[model samples]
Structure formats: C-alpha cells, structure tokens
Target: MKPLHLERCLRTVEADKAVLCSAARVPYYPLVVKKARGSWVEDADGNRYIDFLASAAAVNVGHCHPRVVEAVREQAEAFMSYTAVYMYHEPLVCLSEALCRITPGNFPKRVIYGLSGSDANDGAIKLARWTTGRSKIVAFQRSYHGSTYGALSLSSLSLPMRRRMGPFLPEVYHFPYPDTFRPPFSGTDEEIADYHLDLIRRAFADYIPGEEVAAVIIEPIQGDAGILVPPVSFMKGLRSLCNDHGILLIAEEVQQGFGRTGKWFGIEHFGIVPDAVILGKALGSGLPLSAIVAREDLMADWDAPAHCFTHAGNAVCCAAAYASVQVIEEEGLIARSEEMGNYLMERFRALQDSYPLIGDVRGKGLSIGVDLVKDGKTRERHGEAAAKICYQAWQKGLLLSFFSGSVLRIQPPLVITREEADRALEIIEEAMRDFLAGRISDEVLKTVKGW
Candidate 1:
C-alpha cells in the first residue's frame, strides 16, 4: 500500500497551531477531517479513512446521521438559542423526559442539561454537596470526569490535567480503582475488589467519615484511563458502602453511556442503579449537549438559577439529542454494539497470539482496550509503540487513538458495519507489522502528543 501524504492535513494542523490555543489541543495524528458520514471520514486532502475513534466516542449514532442532522436543521431554522434558565422549551422537556425514561433508575428521575461533560459533572457535585449537606467527594485514581474545577478535582487520570491548576476542591479524595489485568493489589479478581473496597472502608473509618462525604463519583467504565472496566464486585461493594454511609453514588457516564456499552448505559451491565448518572459525549450525537439524570429528590432540593447556564438546554442541541436517542433505539444500535464488540474483541484477541506487544485485552461491549507493552511478562507500558501503531493505522486509512499512554481504544461509532470493522482490524495488524519491521520510525512521533 502507498503511504499516506497528508500535505493538506499537515497544513491545516499548522494553521490550527497558529490560531488555536495549545491548551485546547491533544491531537494524536494530523487527521484534518473535511467531511464525515456514518463510519467514514474524508480528510482535507481527500483521503478517506474508517472512523474508529468516533470523535472521542461522541458520535455513537455516527457522523452527519440523517435523523440527527435533520433535527438540528429544523430546530436551527425555527430558532437557535433560548435562555433555558428562564424560558420553557418543548425540545428541552422532551429530551429530559427521554433521559428520565432511559437512564438506569426505577425511581422518579429529573434531568439537568449542560453544554459539555465538564459542566454536567460540576452540576452533579453541587447537587450532591447540597442535598447531603456534606463537603467531601471521593473519586477514583486514573478516572477522568472533566476539565472544569469541580470535575477536575474529582479527576486524577493524568497529572498534566491537574498540574499547577489546583489547589483543587478541599476534602475531595482519590482512591485506587480496581484493575483486574494490572491488579492494584496482588490477588485474584475477588481479592482485588475486596482490597480496593477495604481501602475505601478504611478511609471512612480512619480518616474521612463517610457521613462527611457528600458523594462518591465514578465512571461506570473509566473512559480516558485506557477504558478501565472494573469488576462487578467492586462496583456492587462500592454501591453498598455508599448506601450504608448515605453517600450518594454518582455515575459519570459521559463517555460510556447511550448504548456505547451495548446497553442503555455501562452501569446496566453491572445491574446497579446509581444515585445520579452524568451523560454528555454522545447525548447530542456530536452536538454540544450533556445532562445529569438524578433521583427526583436530589434535583428537587437544588432549585433553579443555582446551577444554570444560559444555554444549558439550548433548543437546537436538545432537538439533536432527542433525535440521537431515537436513532439509537430505532436503528437497534445498542444490540449492534454488543454484537460488533464481541466480534472485534475476538478478532483482536486472535491477533494478540501473534503480537507480544498486545499485553492485555479487556472491556465491555464496544468500549474495549488493547494494552501495548514492551514485555508481556513485565507489562511495562510501551507508549512509543502505541504511538507508532496509531500513526501507521492513520497512514493506512483508519482513524483511532490511544489513551493512558499505551492502550489502543477501540470505540468506533455503533453504526459501524462488519465490513468496515474487518478492514479496521486489518489496518491495525498491518500497523503492528509495520512497527516490528521498522517502517514506522521515532521521527514520525515528534509532532504528535497523544495521551
């Protein structure tokens, strides 16, 4: 295959550097997208590639989906922005009702909208603190919530996100997240779960009493931390502990919700209902929208204007979100996610037998991770190799990204066809082969700073 020449893409990247803030960029490759539809994206230079990153797992229903596009178009034509804080809008109400219906909770639920995952998480913090009359919040290490102050305080995924920024929210605590593959404590799956849960239990008893903790925020499937999916016992034990202590359990479903995990939400896989669920990435099918679905009482106590954004429930964005939800249900994308996720995992596991670089394969549904390591036994992170694979895959006409230094995140849009997925798998293997054969060089990595 001829090597990709992204001249226009490179030029566009240069333009971005000249105009865009460095703080806003975390680019893995010079993939200057011109147009995207369904599972394919075309570059500025007219080169086409399969989209596996799904715009950082936000386009679950696919890019430019007709239903979502039409909803945006129609809503924009009627009116664009509305001060949802003070005004009533049909779209907002409709979207809220839909969220209440779909989210994992049998109890009465209410919805709060925001423009991104950051603000939604921020809102959840305020509500959790206010409702419980407690100040402390607990989050997992290597878990990402968002960049906003409250969310940032809860996040400890990478030091770069927090460097020189905090003095974060006081009383916010971090604990070990159970990682079965790289068990934080040396033991079996059950032992690992108990060990981590015991740490939290000990913290409640020795240091911060659970009574003082307002909430424990968690990602059902930690997205930015290399798609770390915790064991069921850990999650269940955490929930029980929260219940015993009266600390609210907030599920940050920003990246793993809306059928991306082969269910309505990732928490469903564990058969647990969180006190609140934070949603964002795919809620609007690529539009700027997020939501917090919580129990009615939790939302009721926190009155209006206390946590309101002027465009929190923007009519157009709500329309897009509503249509996006419909697309997931009508197109049966949730089930498709499970089926394709299994197929992709099977194929990747088969490839693992041939590639020592593949150290671990783990995830639920379409939210999978391919951990790369220098030595399989030692399990040392091979960020260099992961970067090379991503670069090679991009050059070979596939779009994807790596996170936590070395895990190849394999979350494509749920609408991806089997044929596209097979081709993507082939490109991934070819990239690995290219890396082992020295076709991908260290020089190629100088420009990209992937996380």
Candidate 2:
C-alpha cells in the first residue's frame, strides 16, 4: 500500500481503459483504494482520503460500521438466499414492519423490497398502476429514478441513458422541476409554485387526463440533477394538487432518504406525506437494498409474484438495513446530519463570498451542492472548473462528486463529525482557489463551460 503500488494501479487503469475513461477525458484519480473504515478510505498507495461522496450516499453511517458489519456477518453464517417463491423469512417480515413504522403516514402500510433503486421504482410503478387502474405516470425533468428501462424512462436527465432505447413506456410525462436556481418563473416562491402547478394542470388538460395519471413521482431533493432543493411551498403545493386530483405521490428518495437530508424521509421537510415512498442508498449501509413503502390498501392491488423480486428482502440485506436504521437512531445521526449540514452550509456560503464562480450554494442536512458558473451574471456552466476542483481535491486527500454539469456535490456520511467537515471545506476552498488562479488550463475551462 505504498505510493508506488498506487501509481501502479493507476497505470493499470490507464492501460485497461477501465475507469470510465470513455465518458470523461481526464484520467481517473491516482490512489486505488485498499480499504475503508468510518469516514476515511485508504488508497492502495497508503494515503487516506476523507470520503465526502460516501459511496454515492449509500454509506450514511460510515464505512465498515461495526453494527452493520456484524449484522451482515451474523446473517451470513445462518442463511443466505431464500427464493421468494416458496417461503417467507423472518428478516423480510421484520424489516417490512420496521419500514412501515418509520415511514410517514399513520395509516397501515406495506413494504415491497428490491435489490436496487431501479427495482424498487419498477415495483412502485406497478403498484401505482394496479391500484389506480391507470397507466400514465408523471415525473419531473432532470430527475433520476434509475437506469433500468422503466425507471430510466421516468428519468429525464442525460439522453444517453434513455435515448436509442427507443419506444419507452407509454403515458410517461415530464414537467419542469421547480428549480429556483434557474427559476421556472421569475416571481416569489408562491408565484413559482403557482406557475409550476399551472404547468402541471396544463399537462393534464392537453395530454394525459387527470384520472388516467396513476402517479406523480418526485425526488424531494433532486440528487443526480445537482441537489436541487425545491421551495417548501412548491412541495406542499404539489402534494395538495396531487391529492385534489387523486394522483398518487411517489417520493423517490433513493439518494436523499435514510437520514441523508436530516430526516428519515426528505418529503418530511415539507411536512407533507406521500402515498408511496421509494427508499434505497443508505438503507442497507452500503449493501444493495431498496423498498417501496405504500399504504396497505393501495399496495393490496399489486398482483402477487409479478411485482416481487427473488432477493426483494434477502435476509442479509434486511439484517444490514435493520442494523443501519438502528445505528442512525441509536447514535442520533439525523440530528448530527442537521448540525453538520448547517456548519457545511455556513462554510460554503463563506466560499461564495470569496468566489464569484460559485453561483449558488444550497441543500438540506448533509446533502449539499455548490454550483459553479463562468460569470456571475450569465450562470454559464463552469463544469470544467468543477471537475478540475474535484481532481485537485482528490490529490489533496479528499473525495467528492460532481453533478448537473457544474455542481460540486457533497454527501458525506451522516456520521461525519464537525472536524471532518471543516477539513473537507478546507480542501474544497483550496481546489476552488486553485481553479480561479489559472492553475487549470484555458482548454479545461472551456471544456467545463461546454464551449
């Protein structure tokens, strides 16, 4: 795990073209990770980087959390896979009950498990359609549901993920997401909400009928779309509209759920309850596990076997998820996320004061985004600068992710302490300063600006 070993790994990656090199021009960061513990990941070169990405927000409690690892180990020794066809397992039932208890809504709820966010979303779609006897679904633009066909069709982000697939599912509609950063309407928050609602009403009037629409899926905080936090009024307005129109509201919390947004469910931030909640990412503490928790009456319409996965509630994943939930509660990670998020936001705002390239800095809890722009007036994307900053931060023993072309996404593990957060802020500031100082090439700048 010396520096030489790390350089060797990077060389191998270069030779093999295995580091998603085709998508991005830059070579991947040098440091092949050896192992991770808590909030730190060690490269093969024996350098430790504070992991702000948190494995794409899947490890909220931190890497190798003792409780979660122990649960997985104990479950592994007992039994592994049990096909959903024959018998029901205790872990599955227990996890379902736990999810029902924690999810919003005082009414009785049911849970359906899956191995990934895509599968859970697929299940949610089926459940919505079956319950309403309708086929049409509405999703926001720039939102990411998953990569699979049904889920990808719901996703309206990058065209590469959906284009050429041709002939996606019918009756899927897209609406402008309430992006205040690039406001859909130039007005107050209430006006923006009303404008978006009008857009939805017009969609229903011109395209899909209100009764024909089965569900309206939304990510309370659009993650892959660059941590776009919609106005509180917008969310509440949507909820009310959905209720009045009899459209099921499906909150896709794949990236922002499970304490990532300082709440068990991001929709809770608006104090509105959704009809169905899709959860993944941090639910299993790094293991692949996802679920759709819905009202019992609504879920009852799903035809058996057709809507389930073999590993829907795999024993080990359920155990890990249970342990993860426990760790979040027992350790008070949700409160910690709020405290740390406020601290990070304060630091980020300070950065904005010093850097004109930072067009906007916003988020809730530990889920945050620092948006980069070429000139403060134009809001021209400075994605290249953002990428350079990410690379520089990697060089300085920090790891983060970029989204929405120009957003520097910071989703550190919920267990991240204030000290660790300060360190991450320092790294980000240094990277931003370096990019502003012409340390990066003009060509690179143009590349990020999408010029």
Candidate 3:
C-alpha cells in the first residue's frame, strides 16, 4: 500500500474501534508519528512539532530517552515478563526500593505496582477501605481521577467524560476543590478555603458520617480540570480533617508526579505528605507503569494475593521506570523543570498582558494552564476561541490541548531547553495573533470543536 493510504487505513481501523475514546484520531494534526525523541515529535509525513504536550507528561525524561531505551533493551536480552506474582525480579525490587526512598514521608514506605494510573488509584481506594474499615470516599467536583468505574465516579472535570457511563461507585461524594484562577463558588482565597473546608465538615456531619469515610482522594494540582492549583490552606485543612477523622489522604499524582511539577511530586509543593501517593505516566518513560507508595503501617495489614496481578511489575517496564528515575537524578531534570517552568511562566504572564483573551495563567514547574475567555470582563470560557487558537498553532506545527473548552494545557518535556521554549512560545504567539487578527476562521473553529 502507498504510505498515505497506509496511514488512512490505520486511522480508519482505529476510528471504527475507538468507541467514545478520542486519542487524536483522523485529521487532528496529520501526525502519524514515525518516531519521537526528546521534545520533538515528527509525523510520518515529515512534520515536526516541539511537543509541549509530552504525552500528558509521560515522557518527562523525554520520548525514548537513551538511558530508558537501553535499560529496556538490556532487560529484554534477559527476559521480558517474569510476572511479579510468580517469582523474584531484581529490577522490580530495585524500582520498588527507589520509589520507597524517593517518595515523601519519612516513615518506612512500601510500593504496589500497576499498569496505569486508574488501577493504581483503584487499588489505593481498595487498600484504604480494607485497612480503615470504611466504605465512603470523598472526591472533588472538578477533579479527574481516571476512566475506570471507581475513577469515573470520582471525576467531575467534563460531564461528557462520564455521560451515560453509568451509575458510578456508590458512596463517592464530590466537594469543591479550591481554584485560584476560578475560585470555588467565586470567593476570596480564605473564603474559598473556609467554604470547601466546611463543605467537607458538613458532609461528615449531615451527609455522610465521618466514621464511614475511608479516604479523601485529591489531585494536588488538578490536571484535567484546567490545571487548578488549590489554596495551601485548603490542602492543610483537608490534612487536618483527615487526621482528626482517621480518614486516609490519597494524593493522585499520576500527571503531576515524576518531576513534572518542578518537584519530585506535586504534593511536595503543597508542603504536605499524603498517607499514600499514586503515580504513573512518567513512571516508565513511554512504557505503561504506575505505582502506589504508601506508609508501611498503612499497608502492613493487607493480606497477600488480595491485590496481586500478573503485570504490575513487568520486568522490562520496571527497568524502564528505574532508568527513568536515574535519568531524572543524573541530569538534574527536576531543577531544570523548575527553572524552565519559572521562565515559561514569566514569559506567559508578559504575553497575558498583551492578550485580552487570556484571562489567567497558572502552573507549577512545566505543568501550566492558560485560561481563555470571551472577554476580559465576563471571563466566560472561550471554547470557540481556544479551539481556533489551538488549530492555528497545530497548523503552524505546535501541539497542545484545550480542556474544559478554554484552558490551554502547556506541558512540555522536562528536557526542553531555553531555545526550544522560545520556539514553542513563538508558535503560540503567532497562533494568538492569528486569532486576534480574524485569520482564525469560524469554519476552522467549528471543524475541530468536537475534538
């Protein structure tokens, strides 16, 4: 088959099977990736974009970092899957130890492995309920946990994400997560903190008894719900409440972990240590791996084989994840992410001053969000404008995403240099210019709106 025809066939096959799951199918960017390295992605058709998306921060060490690839390759020479449940594996043991050592909490910690952030979170909930003997879980209104049944019940980022999905896990309650850009219920920081804090308190008082709640799961920096950074007071308040009630606090750090937040974990920025930390995305570079790092005492009671799975610690994936951590350490990418993040924020704030459509800019490290608005006064989500801007950028060979219809997610790989950052910003500025000058047409906006 011809190359173009082959690409079309692949897309058609996926489109027929995608079934409500959208993973950049069809003419989104004409990118049928041949390969990727570092922060650059090249299409089969030879188009290259400085990847600001970074596969949702999964390639923090960069796509196919040499160390991670070599680790996977070297491990493949020995074996691929030993199945952690069946026997011993050196890589798995090392990775687990690395996790226990690096994750927050001075107390002895243990690690449980999984294939995705969803299952890891589900496992965390299971452990919390089993350990605490409680059935109820507290989640946030605009938070996205994952796509699993339990996670869907917890997520409120986009209604369509859960529409007709089903009656989700019962006893999962939603409360406000403070948003500095769009304050919870539109109030001052202290007021927002107090309101959400009371909402949790009252949930235990009148709604669900505090004794019945097992865990209060949260995304330290809300990723899919438009990159919301909660007030520090709100997080401290939640920690205090959980302490008083004996409810476990689980921080879902799948997207924000692995130095994507300029720190090893997003919770570090909040100056809090969650009882358990859930991680994924960058855990194995581009490979599928995730883990739950919990206090030893917290996981000490769970019986074996209760949560054992076949591929939780696949050998090659473990090696990849281990190498990924090493790369982050040896190259000092965490500090790099922090420095680059600071520079990006400074540049973005200056651009915000020039653009009236940009309502707010906020992020930690490389995880950034730009809020688009219809106007400076109303601050209504300018979904159409965001769509236009993203399409204009895509046409100019830059890949980013907009969620909640108006928030531009600008998560570049940690390996990004100052020059690459400038190039990406130039593309964004040009796209914004197109939108402002009426060059971004209604037809282009309508065409990609559903995407």
Best by lDDT: 1
Candidate 1 residue pairs in clash (backbone atoms < 3 Å): none
Ranking by lDDT: 1, 3, 2
The predicted structure with the larger lDDT, 2 or 3, is 3
Model 1, residue 25: C-alpha shift (Å): 0.6
lDDT of each: 0.91, 0.84, 0.85
After superposition, the stretches of candidate 3 with alpha carbons farther than 4 Å from their true spots are: 1-28, 184-187, 446-451
Which consecutive 10 residues in model 1 have the weakest lDDT in total?
180-189
Q: Cα-based RMSD of the predictions, in order?
A: 1.0, 2.9, 3.1
Clashes of each: 0, 1, 0
Per-model TM values vs. the true structure? 0.99, 0.94, 0.94
Clashes of 3: 0
Report how far off residue 81 is in candidate 3 (Å): 0.4
Task: Tell me which of candidates 1 and 2 scores higher on TM-score.
Answer: 1
- Total clashing pairs in model 1: 0
- Model 3 gets an lDDT of 0.85
Local accuracy of candidate 3 as per-residue lDDT tens digits, 262-329 = 99999998788999999899998989898899999988878887668898899999999999999999
Between candidates 1 and 2, the one scoring higher on lDDT is 1
Candidate 1 residues 140-259, lDDT tens each?
A: 999988899988998998888899987988988999898877886578888999999999999999999989999999998888888888889999999999999999999999999999
